[model samples]
Target chain A: MKKKNDWPFILPAIFVVAVMTQVPFLLTVVYSTLRWNLARPDMPIVFSGIDNYLFFLKIPDFTVVPEFYSIVLQTIIVTVVALVICTVIGFLFSILLDHPIPGVNIARTLIMGPFFVMSTVTGVIWKTTILNTTFGWYGVLAKSIGLAPVDLLSYYPLPVIIFLFCWQWIPFFVLIILAGLQGISGELVDSMRIDGLNWWQSTFRVKLPLIMNHIRVAVMLGLVFIVKEFGLILVTTAGGPGTRSYTLPYQVYMQIFSASNVGRAGALATMTVVLTLLAVNFVSKSMKKNNL
Target chain B: MRANQTLSLQRTAQIKKVIKMVALTVTIYTLAILYFSPILYMLISGFKTEYQAVSPSFVFTPTFETYKSVLSDPSLYGYLGNSIFQVLASSVLCLLLGLPAAFALAFGNFRKKGTRDKIYMWFLTTILLPPVAVLIPLYTWFHAWQLNTTPLGLLMAYVGFHVPIVVWMLYSFFADVPTEIMEASEMDGCTRFQQMMHIAVPLVRTGIISACLLVAVFIWNEFFLGFNLTGNDTATLPVYMSRFREQQGMFIAQLSASSTIAILPAIVVGWMTQKSLVKGLTLGAVKG
Candidate 1:
């Protein structure tokens, strides 16, 4: 069989990806080593020889590095909490709905609504309508009870933000895990039941083991998502309360756009990319080994 | 003796059933309220007038004044049009560039499989890199190329950022398509381009459509790129909303109305392609 080498067919996309994505990425790396600002057009690009990185390390208010670290911590917290809660809830629901349940499809549809909402819209809704200290619905409810309304934005922003994130993402985790659960064979479950294994043992030892890969993949994907997230943080808290809620991506945003420090921002961005790569790679490899 | 054993088993089953029912009911009620409350708030606020928006009352006379204002605003329409055009352009451009590359990577025989794999990994790495990392350099390049503040510039950035993921997705779908189909197409004297357009394209049409829809939503909802890249002429809905918030402050009930409008297209697309959307979200799973 004569297979034609289709470089002609492939060249356009390769060129497009290389020129647009790869070239820009390389330029970013190059620019990270140089001193230049958008505001000063005449400033010659001076090769600073790790000065950008050294400055980031030395400066107190170069909050990008510490801020990125804090963001990573916040991402870990939010992702793990959300993933665990959503997985448990999702698994329980899937098991319940596996049996004959009334209005199951309707319940499913309502549950899936959050997954469809744009992240920005979700952020806006939470910030203005629900969690806003002044005109928010929660505030009204508190006022109606003749109690001093709690300031969610100031007092406990992280937990409140985590709660909102979990609320939006739990439905997604539920849907995916439910789909995985649905794919499990019934005969295997029945056999396990016949062996006098209680529902708890059957779920933990049997069903969960079988669906562990799917769960891992879902959790890892969720981690990537939560880590890369910016819109919610931007809209809801804007990393307020003295940068308490700042995540890596938003930190990068602040450094580049707000502080006009592109080199430091580039270093932060590079570090984030490296961290995410390592995390994702570790997760997938571990899952593969365990599955084997 | 057998009757006694059967009765006890039946009783145990009945108790289990009751417990499961109770557990499910409590879970459903709690989750439903948690998930729906914010959305309900948004919908309700969309109907409130400017005066009522700031009032700390859940119970208020509903009004369509916000929606009316949003619809009547000329800038709102212009922003919406810009968003629509930009999203459509980005989606089409991503598909055009990504599909063939995905085909080559997934189906074609390359001498350097390792290199191809590296390219694939490099693409995935882009998703992790903060968009800000490239913003300054890309902005400078845009100015140098006279591409700044243009819809085409925004579209190019959108396509550049998104094509990798689209390729990653379509690669999996293309891999799933049996090699026999391509073999058969080749046997019929069809060129590689013909094989792709006539054979592979149709085979992965579902994947293509899903990728396009997902990319469209991302592009439409994109803020950083559009906000930084476009001025008034090419500003997207997100940029418009941000400006509205900054300019009008609390007086703008129209921001909520505009937000609801901005999200409508994505919501509709998501509803139509719920299964595909889920599959797209979990693309890594099915492949590995």
Candidate 2:
């Protein structure tokens, strides 16, 4: 009776999750194997096993490698660089805020402000106010110093995007690491100090090892966020300069909305799901290992 | 012997204190500037006149014209209303569906743990899948259902996309509540619903609030889903802001103002719940 009663309560949520998330994913896999386009409605969905995948592999786009590899490479580069920078900086900031310093709360608030700003806002703020070649603050400053103002969007698209990604995501890492820092028992650190360990030794030998799980979680969350990021790309470059800034998600958007190739877009989406699953699985396994 | 040991301990503490202070100060200042610059720039740009905003000169006359422009537009209010309605409806629906499911999973020792875990994983896996993958087919599906360009349609989609994360976050929070509390309530003759309402609800209030705030911010800031799902009639702030480029051209100050307006609510909420906001952002890490 108790078991039967519980089923009604659980069923709605499970139903929603299955229908909304799982079903779409399954459909994406099915669509990837078929040939369909937006232009023709009456045309039957043709079953072309692996054809779309093969075609995508051969296509030469600046975003991906060889033809499609560049995009993936650029994305990997951006994600890695941004993750490393943000994690280090975030750790540093969290350590700072963890101190018994006055105004730490104020400083923390100021630092966290940017994270709340939507990606669209972040993109616009960087592009128009700071990096705009013609009228941006950086451009103005450069020109005043008797130097040519380089258009960030035009000259260093990938770096600019990577920098923005770092800026937006750093606070997230800071908050997480700070929470983890708080969780560390003070007595443990005191005991390490009593054993004649220096601050560096304590941090490296004691503090860091304890927070490994947190760090893993932070990195995984960061990876998921960076992989899924779209607003910044959309607002800033719109995957511009002939697809130089195209990442996997943007490519999927272009294929479906712009190119109207439903099957190819689905194929890209499937690949994204597979990659994300791999990342999630890897992170979870490492976390489990750390716990053990 | 004790005095000597104490003296040596004091000296070491002093040295450690100095190093820690120096490191903390430097890190704090650098992080402050790095994180705060873009937001400061945006807020400053919003107040500047078009000419001042565009000029190479750092010093400029500020004006309220941009704010005036954003406020005077009637559609801005409409967009704001639509955003509020959709976010509130979706969040409410997510909680209604999510809370019970979370309760059942956390408390009920269901027989099929494997099936349950698989379902949970499947839901989380949606976070990994990009929207464009299913965009076309979903579009066709929505169109067939006559849900395109409707607020209810958009809310349903938002609820669908968000419920998994909501469930996961709530589940973790619920799991942490001491089972003894629920068991105690049962011993006191409280029924399941009564126990959930009177016990579980109050205990997890912080979690519920955090989840709601996080979900609200996400719904507010969501662009692609809002862009694809809603037309002008149902557009949210992100979609409204996107229209600025096409409609207003390169009016830099006006654009900044609109951006500022769009981000204002999130900033306010983030400030209020800065602690939990951080917690929510790093939910995956803390749980793992």
> TM-scores for all candidates?
0.88, 0.90
* Candidate 1 per-residue C-alpha lDDT over A1-292 given as tens digits, one digit per residue, 9 for 90 to 100: 4446856656776677667766876877777788766656688768787877676456466645554456668767765676677677767766655554566665676677776676666776666665655676777678879988877867887887777677667766776777677778889878887899997898788888777776776777666776666766777777878888777777777877777776776666666666776878887788778876
lDDT, candidate 1, at B288: 54
- Over the stretch B14-79, how does candidate 1's per-residue lDDT look in tens digits? 999999887777676566655566665566677888888886455888888889888988878888
The candidate that wins on lDDT is 2
Q: Which 10 consecutive positions of candidate 1 chain B have the poorest summed lDDT?
A: B243-252
Task: List iRMS for all predictions.
Answer: 3.1, 2.6
lDDT of 2 by residue, A1-292 (tens): 3443566667887787667666776888888899898777888889999998988777555563564577777777888788889889888777778887667877888888877888877887777777776677787788889999867776678888999998888888887888888888989878887899987888767787777777777788788888878878888878877888888888888887788787888888888767766867887787678767
lDDT of 1 at A106: 59
**Error of model 1, residue B212, in angstroms:** 1.3
Model 1, position A67, has a per-residue lDDT of 46
Winning candidate number (DockQ): 2
For all the predictions, what are the DockQ values? 0.42, 0.50
